[model samples]
Target chain A: MLAFIIRRLAQSVLVMLFVALIAFIVFRYVGDPITAMVGVETRLEDQEIMRERLGLNDPVIVQFLRFIGNAMRGEFGISYRLQQPVTELILSRLPATLELAFASATIALVFGLVLGVYTALRPRSFGSAIIMAASLVGVSLPTFLIGIALIYIFAVELGWFPSFGRGQVVDLGSWRTGLLTESGIRSIILPAITLSLFQLTLIMRLVRAEMLEVLRTEYIRFAKARGLTQRAINFGHALKNTLVPVITITGLQLGSVIAFAIVTETVFQWPGVGSLFIVSVQVVDVPVMAAYLMFIALVFVLINLIVDILYYVVDPRLRVDGGGAGK
Target chain B: MTEPLLSVRNLAVEFPTRHGILTAVQDISFDIMPGEVLGMVGESGAGKSMTGAAIIGLIEPPGRIARGEIWLRDQRIDNLPPEKMRKIRGRHIGMIFQDPLTSLNPLYRISDQLIETIRTHLPVSRDEARKRAVKLLDDVGIPDASRRIDDYPHQFSGGMRQRVVIALALCAGPELVIADEPTTALDVSVQAQIIEVMKELCAEHGAAIMLVTHDMGVIAEAADRVAVMYAGRLAEIGPVRDVIKDARHPYSQGLMGAIPRLGESLERLVHIPGSMPRLNAVPPGCPFNPRCPKVFDKCRTHRPATSEIEPGRRAACWLYPGVTEA
Candidate 1:
């Protein structure tokens, strides 16, 4: 088991390397960063000097190697638009995106598991039918469209929440105090709901089907025949057996969430790695963009590793060498 | 005579199909007395499992008891609500499936499953449950019961898993244990060991068993009385020795001749030639009519009512119409 886990850990390192290589190429080779930095209004002469200054005139390999070197040393150069160290700007904005992602994921998991099992338990019931219908519609709607619809309903029309921002750093003081305050929490509600809908629907559908299939298996039938309550059978036996698949799906979706979160951040105007990524891309701040890209990639690999570990914990069949020839 | 532990009277089960309603079990009736092992022998698709599921009220949606009276200890249990039936199941009437591995929850430890059954019916502390679980596992012949109780179902061998399943069913000390082909999935050698374990354990607990299987050899060895089901109806029922040595129903005879034995000639094993009738298209009178070698015009258009043959034997066939119980 230990050897298998160690091997899996090595595989995770490989994934990070792949992500880093792709990110580096995308940041360096695609389009001129200096043109974006100089803007359409800047003179060609000034642009040349800026290009030379930033070492954009160098070969792609030389530029990438230097970028990788500086990145490893925590020097993300400077933010072109923010006029600050790329690391400082990234660190400041990172909290908002992470907070949003965490909140959304929590919402998705709670609703998904609950509604999923509930529907599986009573698929033909009116309440379960309604939840199934709602989830289908929820899954069909695009994330951007959901965001816009949410902004209108909760922020504009309902007047229940703030449409944008993690709230001013000046107004709320520290991140600790900010979350505790009424305004900060209220601001996060709309964006969090919008982000969770698609993910929640996907999880609920998957969980419902997986749970139904498990319950039909002999083990579940025996559990029932043993006079275990319906609740015990559904939650204890059926749900636990279905979790490995759910975990894998959740990890993969979360990786996608970190990628597509930019659209949500853009809509909500919330400051996180997502909006940081967008601003860096638009202003051609390759250093900050690289920092954000690496962070997301690192998160993806870490989540996958966590999923594999959890799966082994759940099923000994997943444990290599734990069950010799039991495979 | 003491009131039987389980009395299933005129039970019928049906389900909605695309064409129309289909009856799975039609007016089936049987009784199980405490400490008596009743083997229900049948071909595949004989509605044997469905009958057991109906008795426990685990029949899910799209399938329901059309009309029935399931009497357990003077209580008419068929119409009882789901919660009530669920309580009765694994408590008064325990069940084991054909597959031992699948009969246990993959996520739970053996001890947890055993204790869960106990706690559901009777109030018991976790420590008490654990203590009882170890004893129950020991009773079922699981090795290292004291130490291995914490292991999951996947950790145990197939026969051992079936033992655990039996232990689970017997944990609540149920009056009636319905084993739906409990040893069907085990190896030939292991099958005998598991069945031996189950019979001994059940006898020790004074539990009546409704053992469903197609194997007459198993029925001959384990059962006191035997029931033969063909299609959706009971074809014959009597003492096990009578059913095996002198079966009243032709279908039962066919089943007996079906299995190959050493010293038997290379002649074709007698099989009821035609495919078993589908639920919706069962014959008007006798379910086994089409396959019966002595089938008559009356057998085709009119169903024959079950008639008593001897003191304890009853058969649903026209041949037994004039036989008087003496």
Candidate 2:
């Protein structure tokens, strides 16, 4: 198990390196940082000075090595537009995105699992049919549209929440969160719900399909024959089997959730890394863009690693080795 | 004189599809006395498994009991609600399925599955249930039962897993067990071993078993009384010896003839022509009329009711009308 984890960590590093390389190439081709920074009106000599200062005069490989070295030391160069350390800018906004992601995932998982199992259990019921139809709408509608609608209803019309921003952040010694204050919690409600809507539907549909399939297996029939309560058979036997696929999809969806949060962040104006990403792209801030790409790739790999470990914990059949052979 | 342990009177199962309601098991009736093994032998799709499923209240949905009365001792159980039937399932009636791999939960340990069944039907502590589970496993011929109880279903061999399934079925000491083709998925060599274990353990617990199988040899070996099903109806039922030696229904006679004899070097095995009809196309009269050599005018137009041929023998065929009338 330890060897497996170490191997996965090595793979993750290789993936991050590939992502960094791609992001570097893409950013270089998209626009010239010098033009964005010094402006088209600047003198050629002044532009040359800026270029040399930023190490752009060096060969691409040399500049890439320098970026990698500085990144290793937690110094992701200065942002071309902001003139501040890219790492610090990203770190400041990281909390908001992380808070939204965590909240949305939690909401999606809890409600998705409950509704999914309930629908699977009483598939012919009117309530289940309604939930199924609503999930379809949830999947079809765009996130930004959902966000705008929620803001209109809950913020502009009802005055129950602030429509935009992360509200007030409370800094504990090591951890910082906007969730501790009432207005801060209220501010995140609309954006989080908007961000989680699609994921909740995806999870619910995946879980409901898996559970229905599992419920038809012979063991479930035997479970009923064994006099287990419907609750026990549904939750204990059927739900556990359904979770393997659900967890896999949930991990994959988490990656997309972070990706899609960019649109949601723009709609709600949440001060998160997604908005920072948009700003960086618009201003041709290569350092911040490259770092963000690598960071998101790293998160994807780590989530998948955690998912693999969870698979081992949930399924005992996978634990057997060659020693169990020929028995 | 005592009431039969389980009585099924005119039990019928049907499935409702877009076309219409298709009858799967039609007006089948049988009784299992205490400690007796009633072997139900038939071809695939003969409704033997459906009969067992209906008894255990585990019939897949859309297919339901269209007509029947199921009595467990003195209690009328067929009309009970699902929760009430569930309470009776593991406590009064246990079930063994065709495939052992699919019968046991893949994620649970044998001990956990067994103990859960034991505790569900019996008011026992976890520790007590665990002990009983281990004992049941040992009784079903699992080696080092206490230690191996922690193993998952996949860890055991095919025969061993079936034994564990039997142990699971017998955990609550149910008065009756419905084993639907319990040895069908096992290897020929190990099939006998599982059958031996099931027969011995069931006798030890004095549980009446309705053993559903298509293997005539198995029926001859394990059953006290044998029921022969044709399509969706009972063609013949009698003492195991009588059914095998003096089968009255022509379909039963053809079935006996189809089995290969040990000493006789026959040119070819006697096989009955044609297959069991599909539920939608089952003939309006006797289900076996199309396949029977002695089929007559009355057989082609009227469904024969189950009638007593002798003191302890019964068959559903127009040829036995006079015997039944007497």
Candidate 3:
């Protein structure tokens, strides 16, 4: 097990390096940071000195190494547009994004599991039919559209929530959160639901398909024959087996939620790092963009590592060293 | 006679599809007396396993007990509420399935699966259940039961896993165990051992077993009585030795004839002509008529009802002197 974990960690490091390489390429090939930083009125000598100080004149390999090293220490140079240290800017906004991602994920997982199991257990029931039909909308609609529709309904039409912005954030040390206050919680409800809808449907469909398949397995039939309560058979045996695949999908989806929540963040004017990335892109803030790329890649690598371990933990068959021996 | 532990009266299982209703088992009746080993033998799709599933109330959806009744002792179990039937399942009529590798939950340890079943049916404490689970495993011939019980299902060899499955079925001391081809998926070398373990364990617990398989050799070795089903109908049922040595029904005779004898130098084994009819295509009269060499004029016109061939034997064939039309 220790070897397995070490192997996985090594893989994660390789993956992070690969992603860092991509970020480096983006930093190298994209519009010049100096051009984005200074106006046309800046003197040529000043630009040359600035480029030398930033080590743009170094060998490509040296510059790439410096980029990786700076990324490791969470030190991305000042954003070309914002003129603030990219790391501090991202860190300040990290809490909001993390909060939104977590809330949406919880909603997605809980509702997804419940609805999936429900629909699977009663595939012919009216409620299940309705849920199955409604899930199509969640699946087909774009995230921005869902966010806008939710804003129009709950925020514009009903006036129950604010149409835009993180409301009434509270600080826990250096971390700021909108989760503590009433307005803050209400403010998150729309964007969270919008962000969660697509994932919720995807997870629901996955769980339902998997749950149905698990129910057909011989073990479930044996469990029924063993006279276990329906609840135990459905949840304990079938659902537990179903979760093996669901965990992998859920983990990947969670990484996507954190990394690609850009559309929902933009639609609701969410003050998360996604919107910050968008603004940085508009102004060609290369440092912030590269940092964002590296951060998202790190999130994916960490999540994939955690998911692989979880898969091993949940499935005992995977743990056995040798293939199954027939009697 | 001592009361039959289980009774099925005119049981018929049906599956309603878009095409039509398919009768998987039709008008079958049988009794399993206390501690008896009754082997149900048939060709593939002959409804042997379907009968077992029906008795346990596990006929999968779209298929159900469309007619008749199943009784465990005096309780009419065929129509009981699902919850009530669930209580009776592990507590009264346990089941072992075809494949051992799939029968046990892969995620759970043997001890957890065994203890859970024990606790589900009996009001024993967790420790007590664990102890019984270990004892059950030991009884089924697993070495180091106490330690092995902690291992997951995949860790054990297939035969050993089947032993675990047998232990599970008998854990709650169910009065009747339905073993649906329990050894079919096992290695041929381990087949006899599994059968022996199942028979011995069921006998030790005084649990009547309905062994469903097409393997006549298994029936000859482990079953006290043998039931022959053809195309969803009972062809013959009698003492195992009597059925194997002197099968009364034509289908049973052909079935027995097909099994090669150790010393016989026959040029070719006897085989019945034509396959068992599909559920939707079974003829109006006797289902076996088209395949039976004994097919006669009367066999084509009407269905024959089950009738006594002797005091303790029955055959649903018109050749039986006392049989009548349904």
Of the pair 1 and 3, which is ahead by lDDT?
Answer: 3
Better of 2 and 3 by lDDT: 3
RMSD of every candidate to native, in Å, equals 3.0, 1.9, 1.8
* Candidate 2 local lDDT, B1-326, one digit each (tens): 87799999999999999999888898888899999999999898889999999998888888999998999999998889989999999889999989998888888888889888888888999999999988888999888888889888888998999999899988998999999999999999999999899999989999999999999999999999999998888888999998999899998899899999899999988899998899899987788888889888877878888788778888888886443310
Using TM-score, give the best candidate's number: 3
Model 2 misplaced stretches (Cα beyond 4 Å): A321-326, B323-326
For model 1, the docking class works out as: medium
Clashes (backbone N, CA, C under 3 Å), per candidate, total 4, 0, 0
C-alpha TM-scores of all predictions: 0.92, 0.97, 0.97
lDDT per residue for candidate 1 within A196-258, as digits (tens), equals: 888999999999999889978878878877878888888788889888699899887877676
Candidate 1: Cα lDDT at B129: 84
lDDT, residue B68, model 1: 69
Worst 10 residues of 1 chain A by lDDT: A169-178
CAPRI-style quality class for the chain A–B interface of candidate 2? medium
Ranking the candidates on TM-score from highest down gives 3, 2, 1
Kindly report the root-mean-square deviation of model 2 from the true structure over all alpha carbons: 1.9
**lDDT ranking from best to worst?**
3, 2, 1
